[model samples]
Target: MLTTIVVIFLIVYLGMILGGLPFLQLDRTGVALLGAIALIGVGALSLEEAVAAVHLPTVILLFSFMVVSAQMRLGGFYDWVTHKLAALALGPAGLLGVLIVVVAALSAVFSNDIVCLAVAPVLIDACQKRRLAPTPYLLALACSANIGSAATLIGNPQNMLIGQTLGLSFDGYFLDAILPVSVGLLACWGLIAWQTRGRWTDGAALVPPAALHEARTEAIAFDAWQTTKGLAVAGALLVAFLVAPWPREHMALIGAGLLLMSRKLHSRKMLGLVDWELLILFMSLFVVNHALQRTGVTAHAIALLAAAGVHLDQLGSLFGVTFVLSNIVSNVPAVMLLLPLAHHPMAGTLLALVSTLAGNLLIVGSIANIIVVDAAARRHIDIDWRGYARVGVPVTVVTLAIAGIYLALRLHLATG
Candidate 1:
């Protein structure tokens, strides 16, 4: 049973690294779900045990935000915002700066993946319409979104998991994270602006103005009423997270319920935008990781590493491992595997910041990067791995260094 569980765990994480089982057509989510099912089938864990391994608070919090973001998408709020940003009388460099700030701000609140998915296509069309090369702006969007999501616990899935599991204070995390996140956004803007110093126009928008009318975004018109309603709920949820001692998940769930009662938007559309696959991935990883923990291998491995001077409970080790694992198996799964060792003084903050920021290392590092790449491809703008790494590598190095410095200072001051 132990061997079987180990093999399943290895295979599932391999799928995570490769993004799927080779030639099997199964994605990371499928691989994780199958691994859980295999564990149950082999009696490594009972049905009840498998069910209990799931962290419901994280799921509820993630789901509720998905609903809120969906409401924004349905109301065409993202598209509307992108249009407004593009319509500004700014030059390429100026536009990139504004875009970095705006995307980061929105992603800090609405989740980076949702921001990327909803904004990328529209952003591409906007750039093409302006005859600006979409690559730099696209890179900025991806990088800034990842950095910005590190600002708050509710900004990304892994952060939500860490916060709920560790019982982290939402407002407290925000106050600490704002500095690094801001530094990251600034670094993103600077690096991309420097990289694309000369080639800012694509000449693709040379097409007629009338042809440009067919923007790449969905036809969902902006509904001020729906947008205002969603924003109100999001604002209220933010305040509750800041002040109320309530369970963050329950408060978010209540907000989601209120959004579902909309007369203008149907329940189906609102619910449809929720990322069920991501939720399933989270649940599946929880079970697989729990099963592995039961085998005592994780503890044994940690002991071996500690003997070799690799203590993950220390901030430096935690930061380095998260930076590596997040790119390898992706951030969510990486966070799941390392959660047990998150006992350092600043482990929560370190885990959240490094895991999220390191996603900019490669295109496969984060779903937001992939979404942006795919959107650019649809518009005949190619952002290959080399293209992304050009911007991503520097952005990552600068942001991580800034965050490390800040956290180390905080730790030093607190301990002293």
Candidate 2:
């Protein structure tokens, strides 16, 4: 039974690393869900035990924010932001910088994958209309979104799980992440801009003004009142979550409730946009990881590491292992696997930063990357692995180094 569980778990997670089973229609979410069912069918995890494995707080928190982000999307908030950026009239370099900052800020507050989903197509069209090469801005959008999502406890699913499990304060975690995130955003801008420097002018000829004007004509129709209301509630909820003593999940739930009260936007439409598959993925991983723990493999591995004097609290090994594991299984699952042994003084900060930054290493390293890539592909704009690696490699290196140095400084100051 243990071996059956182990084999199924490995197959499922390996599918995750490859983004799907070989030549199979299943995606990461589907693979994980199937793995959970197999464990149940094999009697490795009883129904009650499976239920116990799921961390409801994390799920609730994630669902609530999805509602918030969906409200913003239905309100045309993301479209409005994209249109405003298109109208900036900046040159190639300046526009790249603007794209980096705007995408990063939005992703930090919202789901990076959703942000890319909503913004990438519009961004590509905008750049193509302006005769600006869309590749650089597209890369910037993908990479910066990943980097910025590392900045806050709720920025991404993994961070949400880490925060809840570790009881890390929202504001405290934000403070620790702010410097690394800011520097990482800046580094992303510089790296992408440098990579695309002269290519901007060498691309297609100027897009006629008429074409540019026509492209902006379909800029998503916005309901001004709805947009304002969503932004206000989201803002207030954010402040309350940071400042008030209430648990963040409860606070976000309240905020989501307020959004649903609107008469202008149908509650059903907003609710439908939530990524239920991702929530399922988290729940499934929880069960699988719990089963693995039951098999005593994790305990044995920990004992081996401990005997070799390897602990997550140590700066170099922690960062190194985090980088490798995150890119290996992707960040959320990797964080879940490592969270049990993350007992270092700054483990919370380290796990959040390292796992998040590690996503920038490969096209498959993060969902945000896949979101942007797939979105672009749908538009017939191909952003291949090599093209992404051009920016991802440097961005990962520089930003990770900054994160490590910043965490070490924090540890030094706290210890001193």
Candidate 3:
């Protein structure tokens, strides 16, 4: 049983690293789900035990926020904002700065992936219309979204997992992360602006007329009432998470329910936007990891590493490992793997910041990056890995360094 569980764990994680098993037509979520089923079949864990392994608070919170973001998307709030921003009378660099700031701010509050998904196509069309090159702005959108989402615990899935698992304070995490995230956003803007210097216009727009027409058709008309309702719920939930003595998950779930009971938007539309695959990925990883923990393998591995002077509990060690693993298996699964060792005072904050910032390392590093790239591709714009790396690599290195220094300073001051 132990051996079976171990093999399943290894295979599932490998799938995570590669985005799927070779020639299997299975994605990370499918691999994880299958691993959990295998564990149950082999009696490594009972059905009840597998079910108990999933953290309901984290799942509920993630689901609730997905609904909220969907409401805003269906209301066309993101598209509306992009058009308004693009209509400004700013030069290329100034517009890039504004794009980074706005995307980061919106991502800090909403799901970064959703923000990118809704904004990228519209942004591309907007840029083409202005006779400005869309590539730099697109890269800025992806990098800034990753950095900005690091600002708050609710900004990304991994952060939500760490916060719920560690019982972290929403406001406290925000206070700890704001500086690094701000600096990282600025770094993204600088790197993108520098790379595309004086080259803001492509000779001819790459986007086809048909693609532009399709984008317009798919865009939702901005509905004031729906957008306002979503904003109200999000704001109230923020206040509740900070001040009220309530479970953050419960508060967010309540907010989602309120959004569902709307007359203008159908509940089906909002719920349809929820990434059920991601939720399943979380649940499946919980079971597989819990089974591995029961075998004492994780404990033994940690002990072995500690003996070799590779202690994960130390801030420096944790920061390095988080950065590496986040790029390898993507942030959410990487956070799940290392979360058990997060016992240090600043471990949660470090994990949240590094895991997220590291996603900017490559195109395959984060879902937001992939979403932006895909959106661009549909409009005949190609942001290949090399193109993305030209911006992604530097933004990642600089942002991670800044976060490391900030956290180290915070730790020093606390100890001093």
Candidate 4:
């Protein structure tokens, strides 16, 4: 039984690293779901146990936010905002700085993945219109989004999971995180601006492919009423998360309900934008990890580490491991695996910050990065790993250092 569980765990994670199995059409989410099914089929977990293994609060909250984000997308708010930001009469460096700031702030409230998906295409068009190279700005969009999402508990999936599972105070986490996140955003803008110093536009800048945009029909007219409604709900939700004592999942669902009762936007359109695959990935990993935990393997592994004087519950050890594992199995699964060892005084904050920040290290590290890259590709703009790493490597290292120092200071203050 133990051998079977270990094999399944290894295969699922292997799939995560390779993005899919050889000769198979499965992605990370499919691989995880298959592992969960294998466990249940092997009687490692019963049907009831599998259902209970899924964390409903995290899933519910994630789904609710998807609905809210969908409303914003369908209302054309992201499109309107990106166009306005890109159209500002500023130099390349100044423009990149502005884009970085706005994208980060927007991502902190909505899911960073969704923020990238909705904003990427619009950003590409905007940059092309201004004869600017879309690559650097797109990289900044992904980098800053990852960094900014660490500022709040509800910013990204991994943060939301850490917050919900650890019972972290929403307002408290924000206060602990805002400083590092802010500095990280500044560093991101500076790095990208420096890297693309002289090459802001292409030689063919004056000639935009009118034929390319002529066939594009993705324009959604800005709906003032819908945009206003979505903004009001998002603002209210943030205030409640900060001050109210109610369960966050319940409050978020209430807000989603309000948005869904819209007169112009149909329920079908709103639901269509939800990333059900991501939710499945979350639930499936929960079941797979729970089954593994029940086998005592997790305890045995921890014992071996402790004996080696490498306790993961320590802030420094966990911080380093989170960076390595996050880029390995991706942040969501990495967080699920390390969550069992989150026992340090500030473990929740460290986990949330490190896991989210580590994503900027590589394109495949986060869904947000993938979304932006794919968007650029459709426009015939290639942003390969090397293209991304020129900026990503430095930005990631700088941001992580900033976060580590801030947390260390907080620890010192409390202990002293």
Error of 4 at 7 (Å): 1.0
Better of 1 and 3 by lDDT: 3
In terms of TM-score, which candidate is stronger, 2 or 3? 3
Model 3 poorest ten-residue lDDT run: 200-209
Per-model RMSD to reference: 1.6, 2.6, 0.9, 1.4
| Candidate that would win on lDDT | 3
Q: Encode model 1's per-residue lDDT on 156-241: one tens digit a residue.
A: 99999999999988888999999999977888888899888888985455544443454532646899999999999999999998
Q: In candidate 3, which residue ranges exceed 4 Å CA deviation?
A: 203-206
Cα deviation of 113 in candidate 4 (Å)? 1.1
State how far residue 269 of model 2 sits from its true place (Å).
Answer: 1.6
lDDT values for all models: 0.91, 0.86, 0.92, 0.90
Which lDDT value does model 2 have at 267?
Answer: 87
Model 4 RMSD vs true structure: 1.4
Tens-digit lDDT track of model 3 for 273-374? 999999999999999999999999999999999999999889899999999999998899889999999999799999999999999999999999999999
Model 4 misplaced regions, further than 4 Å? 203-211
Can you give the lDDT of residue 373 in candidate 1? 94
* Per-residue lDDT over 1-416 for candidate 4, one digit per residue giving the tens place of the 0 to 100 score: 99999999989989988998999999999999999999999999999999999999999999999998999989989888998998899998999999888988989999899889888888887887788888888999999999988999888999989999999999899999999999899989888888888999853253246535731566567899999999999999999998899999999999999999977899999999999999999999999999899999999998999999998989999999999999999999999999989988699999999999999998998999999998877777788999888888899999999999999999999999
Best by TM-score: 3
Model 1's C-alpha root-mean-square deviation from the true structure amounts to 1.6
Off by over 4 Å in 2: 205-219
Ranking by lDDT: 3, 1, 4, 2
